[model samples]
Target: MKGMTIIVKTVSSWIKVLVFLFGIYIILFGHLTPGGGFSGGVILAGSYVLLLLAFGREYAEENLPLPIASKLDCIAAFLFIALALLGFIYGAGFFFYNFLQQELMADCNAAGKLVSAGAIPLYNIFIGLKVAASLFLVVLVLSAFRSESDPTEGQE
Candidate 1:
């Protein structure tokens, strides 16, 4: 009684997976590609927003509880900061310097390899997670509060 039609729910349930996967792909390959953490994170949050719209706030919250999302958001932020700070200790006097890349560059074929980007991919991953969780939390919180005129305001 709370969500959209059955057809919408079914379609969204299927499509959300693809959306999520695409977001991950973007985040992972962002060092070589145009789309990066921010864009991919928006896409990831959009997948959950689709679920929210199709299945209602209760169902969406059940899928990704506020507590879990909040934890992930905080953890990702901390990890990102830690990773940046690590550069200060290991690099040539800079933050976010690619120390790992220097080690890998010894190999002639490491130029375009997935792992060759060193800290970039890790940064992208953490940023993607943080952005996705933050955006989802904003949407979920905004949707949680019912308006005075909501039809279900007094319902059990």
Candidate 2:
């Protein structure tokens, strides 16, 4: 808010919006694309950083509270681990082979897509959520602390 002039602020605001949209796209397409979990998470966090850089740390914190972000991170990680454990109950042998066997596999498709592999897709989604939340939390916490330490500065 205080750092950038009017022209810079306008351009940066647009950039932040674009970056945020890109991050969302990455997270949603993670299941079908090569970028899953970690990559998408980092992209999401990067968008937050962009917002901080564009506006200020205070703005970022106001938009994404640390407490909420922390809770999201914890929940995402717990869900990922729980999903992995659930595989055992299905006789999958602890994240073991995650396909529908040959008969069901053929019914789905000739060779079946990646998502058709069952637990693997679920795990990917879980990991993606976990990583995104964790990364965002880390960035927000660190940025918050840094901002508090230096009152005069706008953002890093």
Candidate 3:
């Protein structure tokens, strides 16, 4: 990478890390807080965009590898849908709240805490992963194809 590219990459990588951490925090505290999977996923995707802007499309593609990201996205989507469907087996509606009365469960307040909700937390995780991965992959792939035949256009 060029010196400018290196600087951009470093700063962008730090931003991405911060964005990822914020996304995790949002997802974990989603039940008790305002942000959730969708918001966090958008933030996570923002990191990838930063990377693309800083390093160029080729760098992002080489690092993220479109095929693997695609597969992960598919699997995450399937798992999310499956989890929603699982509620039907317990006589609950789709995406219903079916609490497990296990002793290992965390204590919950009336308004609910970060660890209070059962499936909600798990669902947020799934949605977060799916959204982040999918958005990252999508942006990467899109950037990969954005070019003119000149070849020197994105050389910086």
TM-score of each: 0.90, 0.74, 0.78
- Model 3 worst lDDT window (10 residues): 97-106
Q: Per-residue lDDT for 2-109 in model 1, tens only? A: 789989989999999999999998988888888989899999999999999999888889999999999999999999999898888778767987766675454643
On TM-score, the candidate that comes out on top is 1
Worst 10 residues of 2 by lDDT: 96-105
Ranking by TM-score: 1, 3, 2
Clashes of 2: 1
Full-model lDDT, candidate 2: 0.67
Give the alpha-carbon lDDT of every model. Answer: 0.87, 0.67, 0.71
Local accuracy of candidate 2 as per-residue lDDT tens digits, 1-156: 344567766887778778767766665556567776678678777877766776777787777787887887788778877766665665447564443443245466423345365455566666666776677777767866775688676454
Clashing residue pairs, backbone N/CA/C < 3 A, model 1: none
Better of 1 and 3 by lDDT: 1
Per lDDT, the best of the predicted structures is 1
Clashes of each: 0, 1, 0
Candidate 1: global Cα-lDDT? Answer: 0.87
